[model samples]
Target: MQQQTLVNFQNFIIATRDSGYKSTASALAELVDNSIEAGATKVEILINKVQEQGVEQYEVLIIDNGKAMSEDELNLALQFGGSSRFNSRNQLGRYGMGLPNSSLSQCRRVEVVTWKKKGEFLSNYLDVDEVIDKSLTRLPKPKKSTNCVFSIQSKSGTIVLWKKCDRLSFKYLKSLIKHVQFELGRVFRYSIWRGVEIRICGETIRPFDPLFIGEGVNLKGGLPYGEELHYQVKIPNNEKKTSVVKVRFVELPVQEWAKLPNEEKRKSQITKCAGATILRANREIDYGWFFMGDKRKENYDDWWRCEVSFEPELDEVFGVTHTKQEIKETEFMSSILVPDIEQTARALNNRVRLKFIDLKRIQPQVFSKQQLERNDMYLPPVKKNDGLVKKNNGSLKIKGLEYEIVTKELKRDVFFDVEEVDNCIVLTVNTAHIFYEKIFKALHSRRINNIAD
Candidate 1:
């Protein structure tokens, strides 16, 4: 290949910083994702300050106890779009641009050191600054490992050290370190929570589970259930394939209703019904799509559950732009996925309505037959006189009103034929039992006495 023209390195760095991640901290998160996906049981990251010739420099070191790459694997791992995943069903990585692109986009130089089982340590470095300054399309061989700062002694693992970190221009190195620590914690929190321990500067990172613990509002009944569903569709190549989608639903505890904040509760309701997660393969693409309207915040609490997954083949249909911020819809996707997804959205919306119904204390008469048939089930109606009346035999009725008592009893049983004429309550009850006949006979006697009076 012919030598490329020298590029303006400063302008490229400025553009990358302004557009992709505001700071070096956020950029490092992409690299952490790669480590998590590499099946690392533990990851250690170190940030150290450096000073040379009276000028300040910073270095970021990352080490992982994961399956190390072979010589060929090491070379491919540094190349953009060179992925090892071909047909792995549960693979979290697909694009393969995550490692090198994410690294080069942030730092001046990227260095990798890996140790494979039954082999010597292998190391490589990409000095983007040198390449861009000299205008070389192909990078020269990395310098020998004699000067490498990060190394691994494990029989199988890897370590990456980033040097010449002039790209991260923080007011202070401490501030930059703090930012990196926070971003890594958030991005890899789930993996850390799952026992994949990761430490930054001797402090272990913990996942921030949005579900508040010991907050009376957590759903107590049971853990949510989930299942994956697939559908067949034709793509641009006229090849039929299965599209994967996962669905999860959880029931929140009843006590959580009262303690939850209004804004938090509102978000929870939407999340419970339609906290849709969009993912490419296994990695979550983004939290909400059509399910969460544009104006909503990402504060869905524990009361809600969401479904998260993606169909890898539909990446193009999603209008996945280069930045991956927004999703655009194509005609094919609009017709197929949109309808199915919208139906799921509506199902969650209906579920929210049900939660609201429970909150408002609605009448049980409106519930379905199966729901109403439960022995322990009771949908208490709106209290009469604002609950001044007492509950009698599982029914709320006004007190000191004999006529009202009779009317309530008549209405309590679903078999009663009742209608209101003017201001009075009117109803009829019929039974073939002899006790009922005797009760009416006594009423007849009392009617005669009243007529005599």
Candidate 2:
């Protein structure tokens, strides 16, 4: 018979700590996932900075009002791959490694405390330094404790505490708080909108819908491309299992918004909303250019947006990883989704291009009207004796002009309209013979405050 040696716990813990979590926010998201899976309505994240051995360090705490674990359960929870719901399909947690794997990835020590009722708290912990020193060979057995990691206000709940956080991405608590707020806001937007409350450092987190379609968060004049498209895809290997995937397209107000100032555009995330947002189980999992087939991304694509949402059961099809930060886009997924998405993308792209052309044709007339209204405003001095010398091919040539010319493709009906100011000629062409109807008529319908709008 072959003899097997005991596994090196010290090396295993240290090696697994670097499990490739993209950032501290992602690692923290794993803990939130567990809380959500437990049916927690309220979750709180707290950060505390302290001094130890003349060195400054931080501790993280995640507390939730969920079903508390018993002493036996607590012991197993501290161990890797020891979740009771391991491989369960109905819940968010698939593998049992999220708890310990995510925790140790960011910290050298982690403690879990739970209680089913008042005065019945149980606590257990895992320390990396203790394991490496050979002083602690196994996870401490859960025992009754009067003092909890953080005071559990609820009758039954769980709290996860992280100490010796040497691997955190953000060194300052304020920076980490800002990142966590934005990340978790989008990650759990659906849940937050559905009445789940998540608080960071005593501040309630609000849902940040990336599509900007939700009430109270939409663009001022944005409109949806069309009704949402739905598709039902059967699981590759499981004949009995099927999942529904939803896709939506939103066309932002290009004509009205494209002229916004640079700072305003950046604040509104106009360029950042170009690609598709992938949501798994209503939580945004990954966002990138997906299912566009051979079409490469371009600048005009920023004017339109796409969102793809699918059920958790289709994780394998979408290639969702344990970290839940990205998707692999398996061949099967691309085959089913790319065709339709690509066609719609092409159509939207053409629509945006045409709208931009129309806007360009209409801009000169708008500027001309502005000049009339602001006639009393300051204007650059024109040199004396700058008079029209002759009319050349419907454009006026002047003596000592030194003026810049802007050309436009206008309808044949109207030759050109010109407004000379600030040593420049603002020329407008009658494109499609509807320049007045498109520009003057449209401007009359809505109020125009500034040129930037």
Best-fitting candidate, measured by TM-score? Answer: 2
Return the TM-score for each candidate structure: 0.58, 0.78
Candidate achieving the largest lDDT: 2
* lDDT minimum window of 10 residues, candidate 1: 396-405
**Alpha-carbon error at 373 in model 1, in Å?**
43
Residue-by-residue lDDT tens digits, candidate 2, 1-453:
978658778899899998878778788888888889878899999999989788889989999998888777787778888888776667667777888888999999999888888788888889999999999997777879666646668878899999999998887788999888878887888888888889999998877765667742335455788889998899767868678899999888877876654335556667755789898888888888999988788878888889999877888889988777889879998999999999999999899987866675566433343333334234454343333322234332233222333445564677455555433444444444565555544554444433345
| Alpha carbon lDDT of each predicted model | 0.52, 0.77
Judge candidate 1 against the unseen true structure and give its global Cα lDDT, from 0 to 1. Answer: 0.52
Q: Estimate the TM-score for candidate 1.
A: 0.58
User: RMSD of each candidate?
Assistant: 14.2, 9.5
lDDT of 2: 0.77
